[model samples]
Target: MRARGLALKPYWSALQSSIVSGDDRMLFPPFGNFLVLPSVSPLYVPEDAKPSQEDLQAARGVIMSEAQAFAAEIRSAFVANLVEAHNGARTLDSPLEDVDKLMRLVTSAVPCPSGAYCSTSATFPAILDHFKVCSSAALTASSVSTSPMRVLAIQRVLAAVNEVEPGKVDAAKTLTAELYALGNEAFHCEACLPQQAAVGPAAWSNAHSTKMGWTKMVHHLLVRHTMLGQTLPTVIYTPLKPPSDSGDAAATAETASGGFVVEDAES
Candidate 1:
């Protein structure tokens, strides 16, 4: 059944590659390792069952590392596909739709702390034309959107475009704003901000923080001429820990900074 989804071959291959023993199983795609469903069925523990802080931190590190590896595979493949598309390859009747498919793959490939993931929308015109048309639409959507991941996704795409065609940064911020707006519409919950909502609050906070961080990073790269690194700052999203009494208490509260530090990504 899984093989039928050939586009997901990379993920399946990655999961299979990580398995070192018969005990390895799948809980989720981004998981580094897994036990049988029965072993962790309840998927929660009372306060007494919580692992020590040290153990929890160690586990988070492992999960974060695994998540980075998984995301790297997806990002690399996605970029390659986009570059191929930009190279005047065959037309995707709906290029945005294909981008969404790739985005879905991205979601499954990593444990995005920003909760918003990346912008779910994009449009690619030929390299020579102005990006304004597509970027304007994206910025319009991002204006009311809540997810920083969406904004960051737009930023990364523009950055990639600039890498291929230089001088694209001239209007990329406007593009970023549009992507941010789109994500805001799709994911942000205004009723939940300032800890008022009862759902996915940590994700909300993380998304907000990540968005700000990306905004700064983008400015630094595009305006200040910060050296480009191999990765974007958005890749290192680390969700803040929610209070133990919250509904998310079952979630480990250890620090999620595992990928926050990396070599410069502006290159």
Candidate 2:
């Protein structure tokens, strides 16, 4: 099932290849190195358990390292797929309007942090076109949205978690927003965001987060975004055009940042 879905994503192979094992830089304290990790609600940890100081520190390191691995993999994958899409554009009969849809379909197949936007209500034209659009959008004196910038897709997923589970969504939403903020700035802003700092607080330094917790959150977000038919589809999107001032590139100093499956230790 995983392999089948991954094939649809042009970049999944690279991202998954680099994720062979958690990078030791963020190595969490192994509860018991499972020859095979289990699948469950709180797969990484036993529910109601408190992490010891050693566990906290270890989890922080592991989560940070894993986050980096995920980010690198996503970047590589996106670049590869994007380049392919650009090349394919010349041969494919598809029109320019279909470009974002193609990118979304490819990205949806991967269970990475970068996939969050596939379900977004925002419209990101070709990122290469962002500066041009920003300039034009600003010139028209068109009013920008006052809504808080959040990952439109993950926001709904988080809201669902809040409804179904007793105490899960709020923290996830907070962390997700932080990640989104840092992520947007890094890619969209004129000044690149501080990926390390963005990921540190919610992931590295936070006491409540566990090695397994990081993994669980990532999986949950992906699964929630999947269609009931269990196949990728052309995403139906609502566009939230971003503000233009952010292109200045000077605001990348601060920001926020996790995981594939929840481990038993995370619960």
lDDT of 1: 0.30
List the RMSD of every prediction in angstroms: 19.8, 21.3
The TM-score values for the models, in the order shown, are: 0.24, 0.23
TM-score of 1: 0.24
Backbone clash count for every predicted candidate, in the order shown: 18, 23
* Top candidate by TM-score: 1
Model 1 alpha-carbon miss at residue 209, Å: 36
What is the TM-score of candidate 2? 0.23
